[model samples]
Target: MSIIKKLASQTAIYGLSSIFGRFLNYLLVPLYTYHFSAAEYGVVSEFYAYAGFFAVLLVFGFETGYFRFRDKNDPQRDSAYSTALWFVLGANLVFLLLIRLVRTPLSEALHYAHHPEYVEWFAIILGLDAIASIPFARLRAENKAFRFAGIKILEILVTVGLSLFFIAYCPPLYAKNEQVWFAPIYDPGIGLGYVFIANLAASGVKFVLLTPQLKGLIWGFDRVLFRKMVGYSLPMVVIGFAGIVNEMLDRALLKYLLPHDPLMNMRMLGIYSACYKLSILMSLFIQAFRYAAEPFFFAYADKSDARRVYADVMKYFVIFCMAIFLLVTLYIDFFQYFIGREFRAGLGVTPILLLANLFLGIYVNLSIWYKLTDRTLMGAFVSLGGALITIGLNLWWIPHYGYVGSAWATLACYAAMAVVSYLLGRRYYPVAYDLKRIAFYIAFGLGLYFAREPLLTYGYRSWQAGTLLMGSYLLSAALFEFRGLFHFRKKLPAGDSGKSLGPGRK
Candidate 1:
């Protein structure tokens, strides 16, 4: 329990950036949806969907690899860090050069020949982010959560500031035909492209700020260590690629899979993407938890009680996720306003996507078994299976149901992945996850959500009904789970005269 508290504290600090800073960036969803047409926003969404795959590929999973190899007191930790850092930098540099060579052909193939700069801009963004990932991983390994959070927040601040200046402020000023001081840089022709430019600028700023951590390269690379790390981390690339396929393949495919014309397909994709942002609350918490829990899991794995600790963490994670699930679904009327009126038609997918992300978070917790046991290949196999499911379902259903089918496909993929991971962990690295309670909470939260429509006829307003449901779940959770918090310590056996039982035990 104490260990869980430490993990929670670290997550909270990281959340200062992940939740708050990203919330600032998350606000841009509305800005784009309101200011741009659905088809225009779809252009931004599709490019990012493509960037997601490259983001995973260029890193080569070295972020996790670095954490796996570096420990607090290891004499060779510097060699491990230096090896990973230099390798990632080299890989990203090669990637950028390749992008430079092929940008024209790639842009033509993607129907962006007139805007080849989009390809170059996104390529640079990906390379910069991949290079910066190693330093960020080092901060986690070293328990420098404050520094980590500060840098992350700084990056997002730059993103938000530039986005507002280009997308919101500059447009009106340029439209007025005013000779503004910033006129030299503002290009009205960029239009929706401003979003990508803002992101590229943010990545550049982050890379510059991370220069101090780049000093690890002075330790010099180790050829032998690099091979071992790559051997271990390469399978993680498969896992990550599969994970991206599960998450983003829908957006990438939607523009092709829809039965409608290309323009309408893009408009539908834009609406789907806009509603998808409604799940940001759940995604934000899971991300912050991952940042804290990944290193914490590796460091604590040697302890005898680590499995018990992981079990406790899993239970608490599910509870909080269920709370998020109910919060979003019950008050969805309020969240719907976050996007433009044009995008509100797809709001039905919000709950489906939120539940899907909840399952993904559970899989993240279950994934510790493979990482700690060095069975990453098995993890890769599980993720591949999910990816197959994602691909097959999207191909089959997208033509018929459109974006709604994509949402359901996502839910199905994550749910199957989580269940499979839990089953595999039981065989290879078992933890006594409280399945009964976890299932109960999920069912309970869904019940509250579905009951809202019928209960609205009974005289309560939507908000009033939502408040009652939210209060009921929270109160029930406190009483059912935290009853142990109030337990009095029992006396030790008479024969145990000189020994203490444990913390919180008498």
Candidate 2:
């Protein structure tokens, strides 16, 4: 219970950036959906999807490798940080140069020869972000959560400010009076491209914000350590690539797999992506928790009671995810308004995707077994299996059901991976998780969600039903974990043994 409190505290600090900062970023979704056509927004979503894959390639998993080797294996290690930083820096440099050469050909292949600037801009943005990865990871490694949250918030502000300048403020001013003071930054022809440009500008600012990380740091590269670290972390790249497949492949694949024309296909993709953002609350929590949990888990791995702590964390994680699932799905009528009217038709996929993200978070937590045991290749295999499921299902289903099929495919992939990871993890490194209780929590929350629509017309209101469902569920959880929640201790008679019984696990 104490350790869980610590984890929750850290997650809250990290959430300032992940949830709050991204909430500010989420404002852009409505802005984009309202201003640009669905086809235009889809292009932005598709390019960012490709960026997700490239970002993984750029890091090659050195961030986790740094955490494992420097912090856990050899706490006194001095050069691991510099070694990882320089290696990724050089890799990103090479990537930037390579992209410069193929930018034209790549643009033409993507039917964007006329706007190769998009490809050129994103390559630089991705490369710069890749180089910044280690500095950012260093903050996490050192438990510098506030610094991290601050820099991330600043980055989001840059993005939002630039986007508004170009998309909202500058356009009308430029049209009515081209000589206005801020008119030069606006270009109506750019359309959805401002979104990418805003991203590029903000990414550049992230480097500047993190410049202080370079001080008091060793830049000297250790060839031997670099080689060893890469050897260990290389398999993580596969895991990361597969993870991206589960996340972004549907958007990329929908273009060619669907029978519709390119424009119409993009429009449908845009609709799905917009609605997908509506389900991001669960993912937001997972991201925040991951940032805090990964370092905490690794740092505490050597403790004798670490497995018990991990088990408790898992139970609490599922409980919170289920709560979030109900929170969003129960009030989805309002969330769908975050997207344009055309996009709201796909709101049915939100709950499916939300559950999928919950499973993904579980898989992430389970992945620590492989990370701790250094059996990272097993993690790679699990992710690869999930990737295959993602690819096969998206290919077969997209033609028939479009993006809705993709949503269900994501849920299936994550759920399968979670089960496989748990089974394999227990075989190799058993943790006595209270699976029955956790399963009941998930099932109960889902039952409440499913019961919402049916009761809507039977004199039940959403808020009223939501309050009843969530309130009762919380009370049930409190009673189930009363020992921890209430911290009850037995009363002893005066002068009697002077010892009191503490709370017991139910």
Candidate 3:
């Protein structure tokens, strides 16, 4: 099969889990938004932002290391795996111990000293998830895409099911029969804490399900292999850390930089976070694309025409992402219903964030230049630059503008990285990406978007207005650039006909 076809198949399978899993989890947005106040949901948002940061640390770039080294034609693949496993295991153990030892200080730092249990539980959860990551990467490398997708879907289903039962169903049952099983442990006042417990339970179940992958693996540690993998993966650690900080630093900083009330600040964050989830469709596509593209890129890196293929891939990637952005923004009046009424106030940021995510996806496509060339340190530098820009913008803007500042900070950070990478990649590796044509498409889409508001003032229904705008954009592409829309394959003439047409094959 062609590489593109193979990638599409794998992406479909992986996206099944991601799309459906996200949709299922998406249900929780309404549940949480309805049940908890914006402030309460903000706690959930803030904590998970920390989770994203800590997760990058716990995995320590071993996932990328596994991918980089697993293809080596050596007998030490198992040794590499074991070495990475042991390194994370040791680090996680030490991390957990340290957190436990300083639980008081940690709790105080988070201003949740009364809830040190939250810290303790979160620490254990992070540790388990970190250790599980290497094996997960192994699954991806081994092309066990089906198993990987299934486990992921199963985990999401279990988590969603438990959360619904606890938050939506359990309260009513307990209210009617106070003497029912485990009544003492159930507290409706705990609010967002139930979300955490459900996550812990689901994560534990995934660890159990992944035991088959763990079984029968040799467990011997190799110091030499460990050193090599660390050397290779350390740059990726910096890259991952900086990349996540660029994405999440605003959320972490907003609590302190914004106004005084913890509850109000959290509420604003929650509103922003919920509205941000609307962009998950684009994020999900990029994620599935990356999962397929990474290994495919490495495998094809030595091919003579690889640069052309990369250029084609980027063109299509930008096309599809822009298409998604248009769809979301054009129909946002309807999409706003995904969150509760309180969150609708933050809907203004959704379009801005969606565009930022599109830029981020483009940046990921451009990043292949560095990865395939073994100039991975370039990625670290690019991400660090973006992170620094994000921090600076948030600090400068958040005090004055609050959540709007965070939104602009995110947009600026991603736009900077995408443009910077494209310029640098052209100098270093030089893929002839259709930048002029892509920019035209973006400009046309934006024009269509801005024009829609004025057109809607003429008494069109919301859907009618969106449909008109989307159709206009499509029609514009078809008319002005229809040749680019067509896919043609050249064919050879039949035996005798080939001879007749040999000199002038048209």
Candidate 4:
């Protein structure tokens, strides 16, 4: 198969987990928003925002580091895996210990002193998740996409199932009988803590399920390779921490910056975060693609047409992302129902956030250059710049215009970051990206999004306008830009019309 075809197939496989699993998890948004007040949901949102920061720190760029080094020591690829695994494991244990030492004070500082267990739950969740990172990366590197997807699906199933049982089922059961069979497990006062507990359980189960991947592992560490991996991955610490800052600092800053009661501030943030799920479709695709693309890019780096494959991946990624943008934005009236009505007030930010996510995805694609060229320091600089933009603007905008300002800040930060990454990538490890087509798709997608209101003015239902616009956009894209991919050749004996570039399989 062609590299693009392989990428598409693998993305689909990973999507079975990343995309579908997230979709299943998406059900939790409704459950949470419905079960908890916007303010309560805000507390949940804030902790997860903090979780994003720690998650990045706990893994400390080892996922990408493992990818970069795996091929270097091909004779013992497991050396890279084992070293990366041990490095993250040690870091997580220390980090969790430190959290244990300060859990109460840390919880108080975050204004969650009433529920310090949040600290303990997330500490364990982050540690287990960080340790699971290498094995998941190994699955991708080994092209075990199906197995990866399966475990991922199972994880989400357990998470979502338990969340529903706790938040929805147990309460009614207890109401009927406080002496119910699961009484010990159910606590109504704990409220949103169940969300964290469910997530913690799911993450722990995933870690256990990955025990097979951990077996037969050598315990000895290579000091030289360890230093090299650290040298390569240390910069990722900045890049990742800063990237999370860009992605999540708004929610964090909003809690402190909003001129309202603590609960009110959380309400505002909850609203922002809930509506932000409107862009979850794009978010899901980016995740699935990232899961597959990182290892794919590393593995294909030495290909005769590596640059060409990278370029194709970039163009196609934009095409699909743009398509998602139009589809989601046009139909957001329905997606708005994913959150409660109080949160839907922030739906105006959805389009902007969707575009921001699009740019972020492009930034991730452009990032392959730095990863491949071992220019992680440059990547760190770029992410630091983006994080500064995110912070400065949130500090400036939240007080003046609320979460809308944060939304615009997100877009501006990512747009600036994408341009900066592209420019630096060209200078360092250039790929001839199709800028004109990318610009056209984005412009066209935005144009269609802006037209949604006008179409709705004609009294068509939101879904009707959405479907009509989506169809028109797809048909137009096909006629003008995607027609060539439509042409087909007679099947060869082996089914691939393109020249077989490797050893015969049959």
* TM-scores for candidates 1 onward, in order: 0.96, 0.94, 0.92, 0.94
Q: Could you tell me how far off, in angstroms, the CA of residue 467 lies in candidate 1 after the best superposition?
A: 0.5
lDDT of 1 by residue, 397-503 (tens): 99999999999999999999999999888877888788898999999999999889887988888899899999999999999886744551144344442212122
Q: Give candidate 1 misplaced runs (Cα > 4 Å).
A: 74-77, 486-506
- Top candidate (TM-score): 1
Candidate 4 lDDT tens digits, 105-145: 99998877888999999999999999998899888888899
Model 1 scores worst on lDDT over the 10 consecutive residues at 497-506
Q: Write the per-residue lDDT of candidate 2 for residues 388-483, one digit (tens) a residue.
A: 999999998999999999999999999999999999887776777789988999999888887887778787887787777778778887787876
RMSD of candidates 1 onward, in order: 3.7, 4.5, 5.3, 4.4
For model 3, residues 1-506, the per-residue Cα lDDT tens digits are 15556777877777777899888988889988987898878877878889888899888888777766664576334767777877887899999999899988888899887777788888888888898888787777677888888888888888899889889887888879988786877887765678988888888888888887664256667787777778778878788888788778888888888875877888888888889889988988888887777777777766655666676677667767777788889999888888999999988888888889888988988987677666777778998999999999999999999988998899899999999998888777777777887888788778877877887798887788889888877776666545653422223233322122112111
lDDT of 1 at 225: 88
Q: Is candidate 1 or candidate 2 better by TM-score?
A: 1
Over 4 Å off in model 4, which ranges?
71-77, 484-506
Rank by lDDT (best first):
1, 4, 2, 3
C-alpha-based local distance difference test score of model 3: 0.80
Over 4 Å off in model 3, which ranges? Answer: 72-77, 181-185, 216-219, 474-482, 485-506
Q: Lowest summed-lDDT stretch of 10 residues in model 3?
A: 497-506
Candidate with more favorable, higher lDDT: 1 or 2: 1
